[model samples]
Structure formats: C-alpha cells, structure tokens
Target: MLPEIITPIPGPRSRELAGKLRRHESQNVTYLAEDFPVFWQRAAGTNVWDADGNRYLDLTSAFGVSGLGHTNPQVRAALVAQSADLLHAMGDVHPTAVKTELCAQLSALTFERWGAGPGKVVLGNSGSDAIEAALKTSLLYTGNAGVIAFTGAYHGLGLGALSTVGIPFFREPFRTQLKEFATLLPYPFGPAGDMLRLRKELVATIQRRAIGCILVEPIQGRGGCVVPPAEFLPMLRTVCDEYGLLLVLDEIYTGFNRTGALFACEDSKVVPDIVCLGKALTGGFPLSACVGRADVMDAWPPSSGEALHTTTFLGNPLGCAMALAALAEHARPAVAAQVQASGQRLKSALEKMRSPHIWNVRGRGLMLGVELIKADGAPFTDLAIAIVTRALQDGLLLLADGPASNVLSITPPFSIDDEEIAFVAARLQEYLTALPGSIS
Candidate 1:
C-alpha cells in the first residue's frame, strides 16, 4: 500500500519551494532539475512523502545517509535525550563524557571488525572532514606528501579531498589552487584489467615520487558501484606492504552493512592503515571518523593548548549519542543477513530482465547499479535519465551515478521489504521495455 501518487511528480508545492530555493541558493549546489525537483516533507522507514502529499518508495535513502531508515525511533530518541542533557561541548579542548564514550565505542568496533590492534579514532563532522584527517595522518605518519589514488574515486569536494578525486571535471576549475600530490591509477574491474601492469605502475610510482599512501574505495560507490576483482584489494594490501605505503580505504558509502559486511574490506580480509567512515555513521546526523592502527595514529604529537586538526564540532553530543545508537542497531547479525538477502534478490531480478540496453548489473549488498548502453556499446546517459525520471513519475525515487551518469544507482534502505523490491524490478522492466527506439 505504498507509492500513492496523488499528484504529478514534484507537484505544485515542490515547484514553488524549488523556485524559492533557486532565488536564494547557489546555482552549483542544486543537482536536480530546476523546475521538477521533489521537495520532501516527511519520511519514515522506506517511504518519503513529498510536499504535495505524494508518497513514494525511497530508493536512494537520501543519498545513502539514512541507512537505518528515515527517522529511526531509536536514533531519534537518542538525539532528543542528548539534546536535552547536553547539546554543545568544547571540542578537543574540553571533551564531554558522551564524546569520550563514542570514541571508545568506535575504537573497540574498529578493532573488533578490522583486526587492527588498539585502534584509535579521530571524529569529524562529515565524510570530507574524515578524508582530510586521513590525508593529514598519511602525511604525518610517513613524512611524504605524495599519494596514490585510483580512477573513479570520490573522496569529497573540499580542496584537499577534491585534489584526490579521480574525475577530472571536479578538479579542473581549481587545478591551479590544488596541490599535485596524488597520482591516479585505473581500478581493476574484471579479468581484462591487468593486475601485473597495475602492480608495476604502482611500484614505479612509489619509486619515483615520495608517495606515502594509496587511497581507494573498496567498491567505488559514485563511480557506479563498480566492484573490483576478488584479488584487487588483497593485491593492493600486498603492494602497500612491499612498498611501505599506508593504505587508506574510503568506506563512506560501503560501510555500516551497506555491502553485507560492517566494512567492505572485510570481504578481502584486507586491513587498511587508515579507514574513512561516514554517511550512515550517525543515521543521518553529521558524524564521521578517521580510524587507523594505533601506531600510525600516534604520529601526531600530543596536543598542548591548541590542537592541530580539531574542528569546532569535533564530537557533538547529539551526533555521538545517535552514532552510538545507530552502530548498535546496525551491528545486529540479522541486519547484515537481511542486507545480503535483499541484495541477492534485487540482483537476481535485474539479471532476469537482461535487456539489450543493459551493459551490466553490478554491486554488492544494497549498493547496486545498472549500467545502460546503446547498440554501439556507448554509455546511454540520456536513457538513464529518462528511466529515472519515469521511475520518479511512477512513485519510485531512483538516482543516476557514474562518470558518464549512465548507471542507475539502486541503493535502498536495508529495511526495504521484498514487495518493494519486486515493485522496483517490475517498474524498471516496464520502462526499459518501452524505451523509444532513439532517445534524443
């Protein structure tokens, strides 16, 4: 009894709000269509209601932030309780009891999951902040400024993180201001990708440059949820070991049971020197962590009066409490199992469709993507847009991702039921089967 579309997609109120936003906000900040952006009023579990009272099944999970589902009762209660007790605290200078507790919990969880002995964590306000911390940690630990990053990588848009992003357009405008510290390499996708060549390239790059770290995503999320070969991460670990490079894994999207494991690196048994975690960390509240081996984290000297890399909201009480509650809920065995099952079900359904337009279907757990292609095997970007737009009209919220924006990113909340999954598949089939012979 979901996806009750009482009005046209985006409707009147949404368009009005969007128009107001266009007048006030920066043009570059809004990605959705100017005239047709859906303005959400409320959300619960896997359903979101737009301003026009149109209910839709939320598949993007609000850009994968609401992993525990929108307005999770436990996380909401924790946030409320923490706000009443203590909302703000002096960050880094005078830490609160909740901050201390959250740090301890994160450290213990990292150690237990990744097998890093006595892990240490540095909390930040967002994924970009966590990536910045990891980058600084790499520089401090190895005494080298050079970094090795992979193609299709998206650390963040901050100046430091943006420099490491793989997409050229994201870095083009600020090329002069950004440092040339990172060297980009191709991430292995399948058997066609040459591991030996990549290994040689990595070795040569390390030998030539003062490279200190190799930053990569276990499964490239924005790069269309591209999953590398089984041996890719393990081989990267080997390369890191041979060259004494710190391996920094950005798990901002793949972490917290999104990939059927607490962390995607767990599948390959590859423990990184530094791991960046965010997105679903606090179940929607802004919280992120840069966790690493104790020895590596000890590179920075003890703080005196002024800490070097501390933010004003380093460990907000509300974020800490909600993060603690979210982690406890996600760590449940049943949750992980359900994610695995849901991912399998969705993948199987997508595979069954097997349209000529689909170039590939890939991903693990709930972070899935469908790559669309033309007869000539070129990326069908317009078709992707049309499909997603159609899906929206049908009361299903979908997102497009990838360098070419031709992959349908199907990341739903872990709480999505089988019926919703079936509906999504059926709607996708209907749209794809009815694709016009030629899209402009």
Candidate 2:
C-alpha cells in the first residue's frame, strides 16, 4: 500500500512533541528540526501512523527491527499472553519457562541446522548487548583480547562492541574509553580478486596480535548495506580455523530474512563460532541473543550461584514469548523465497534508471542501498539528507546510512507487497532524477 499524506510532514502534534523532547531529553539524542522528526503513534505491517495522523510507508522498518512487520499479530498475542502469566522473572536466578524454550529454539535454528550441534545462548536487551555478549564469549573461549573487524562495519555502540566498530566517527571520540583490542581492516567490495592479499594480512595480524576473534556483519547494515563478495565469509572462516580464533558473525541487522536468508552468513554456509542476533529477533521487542557453539560457549565457567554476567532482564518473559512467535513465522519455507523475489523486483526497477546523482544500487533482499553521489563523484551526503527530509514530506520514511551517511538505505519489512515495492522504487526514481541539479 502507498503512503497517504494528510497534514504537513511533522505537522502540529509532532512539533509540540519535539519541543517537549528538546527541553527534557538529551539534546544529543534526537535531531530537532521544524520539518523533521515525526512522532510515531502506532505502526503495523509496513505502514506507520504519526502523531499528526499522517500515514507513511515505512522503508526503515524502524531501523530494520520489524522484519516480521511491525506489531506482528502472533508476536503481539504471545507478548500479551506472556504478560498475563509473568510480568518479570529473576533471569539469573529463577528464569521463566519462555526463556528456556526460546533458548532451545535458537539452538535448533542456528547450530543444529548447521550441523554444529546445539548452541548455548546469552540473552540481552538490545543489539549492542548481543554484540558485547559475542565479544565476551570470544574472549573467554580464545583467551585473546585482540579482535579483527572490517572498516565500514557497525557492530553496535556498547563499550565492548565499540572497540571493534569500524566507523571512525563513532570510535574517535570514545577512543580513550574503548580498549585498544580491535584491529580494523578495510572491507572489500567487487570480486574476490584482492582476497588473497587481505587473507595474507589477516593471517599476519592474527599471528602478530593476540587476536581472539574476527567479528563481522555478513551484510553490513549501517555500513550502507554493503554486500561483500560471496567468498567473504568463507575466507574469514578459513582464517579463523587456521589461527584457532573464533569467527563471530554480528547478524543483528541481517538476520531473520532481512537478507533473504535466516541469516546472511547462511548464503555462504560458513558456520560462525558465535552469532550475535537482535533487531528482528522478537519482531518488536527489546531482545537479543548471542548464540555460540556448545563447545565454544562452554569456555565460560559454571555460574558460582551469583552469576558473573547477568542482567536484571536478561530473559524477559514478554520478549522471550514474542521471540518464540517471531521464530515460528520466520521458519516458514516461503519467507526467504518471497523476500528474494521482492528484492529482485525493487533492484531491477532501481537499476533500470540512469541518473547522474545515482552512483550504485546494491544489497540483497529488502536490505538495499542507493549510493547517492555528486556529479564530481564525491559522496552527496547533503543531498541524501535533503532527500530524506523531502521524502518524509511525501509520506515516505527513509534513512541515510553508512559512516559517511551518503547511502539511501531501504530496509522495508518482509510484509511489503509488490505494489509497495513499486511505490518505493517510483519515489526513489523521483528523488534520484531530481537530485543531480540540486547537488553542488
């Protein structure tokens, strides 16, 4: 379904909310502007209703978290049912049965499916939590402090995960707060031609530094949905094996059919030692899981009753139940194929048009990026921002992605129909066609 514009973009109600938010909330948190920041009242499927009653076709999927669509019925029902049964649980002590079941299902979905046996899980509240969990697990298992991560990669902003983050913009300011344990290598694109050189460097780095693991996003989400060559994961897996280092896949954004696979790494069949998952895990709940092979995760010593690493809401009942429901939906055999078909339709439409402002269109499934650029070939960061602002007025929500913020990212929900895909491409075409002359 296409978006319907009612009141002006942010309209009166959104402006009121923005003013209140600016006064009480951290100024650094949300960007405040007259024509921006629509306060979402409610969302469902692929549509979002704002405070001003404006309905927009969601292209962001709320930062790629609602892959099963916003407020999925089954997930919502499970969440409500779980709340009636148990509002909270002492995670480290007396955990809920929902958590137990969720963990078992996660093991079967991941390691068991890969023929790696059952996996152990560390539950968390956010994507960052999952990243940190994987980092800690890798450290515990390999007993090495150093980590290898690719440049242009984003693995969340938590302190432990921050050290391994490749975006200099995020890492530079907090460099002092972060441990000097991560080595950032350039992320490759195009063919696997230069992979040999990269492999040599990676091997040397592993030997020279006390590297515990190689952390990566199978399809770099925040990094402009950058899809590396098919050899990427296989290469990492081979090196990690040779050096006896863990291969940690941060599938937070690329998991749950976002990349037309249960996990993007599945396309390569490269089973990771640790997989950090979140975003679409519970469809709309604050939940995440860091799953690792049983043997690898067993590196952690048994809890001395007190539990060394535990959160108050480690396995929240509401989130766990929602996750169970989302998992069942994601397991549908047709989901991945449907996503792939939708992706091709959108990709083909975007590629058919030629514009000076368009640099490239790339990515898989619903996770795609239109690389906005200037006539001079430099990144059109300003143009991308302008497009997002303009698109919001058109009852379409979009986000500029990557460390440079020059990629117009499209991460719509799987529930988006063919008509919705056509609408997105049409809107994007208009933006692309109009931006060249505007860019300076």
Q: What would the per-residue lDDT of candidate 2 be over residues 104-215, giving only the tens digit for each residue?
A: 9999999999999999999999989988888888888888988999999898888888888888999999888988889999898856548888899898898799999999
How many residue pairs collide in each prediction? 0, 0
At residue 16, candidate 2 shows an lDDT of 96
Model 2 stretches with alpha carbons more than 4 Å out: 435-440
Clashing pairs in 1: none
lDDT of 2 at 281: 91
TM-score against truth, every candidate: 0.97, 0.98
lDDT of all predictions: 0.89, 0.89
TM-score of 2: 0.98
Local lDDT at 302 for model 1: 91
As a whole number from 0 to 100, the lDDT of residue 245 in candidate 2 is 92
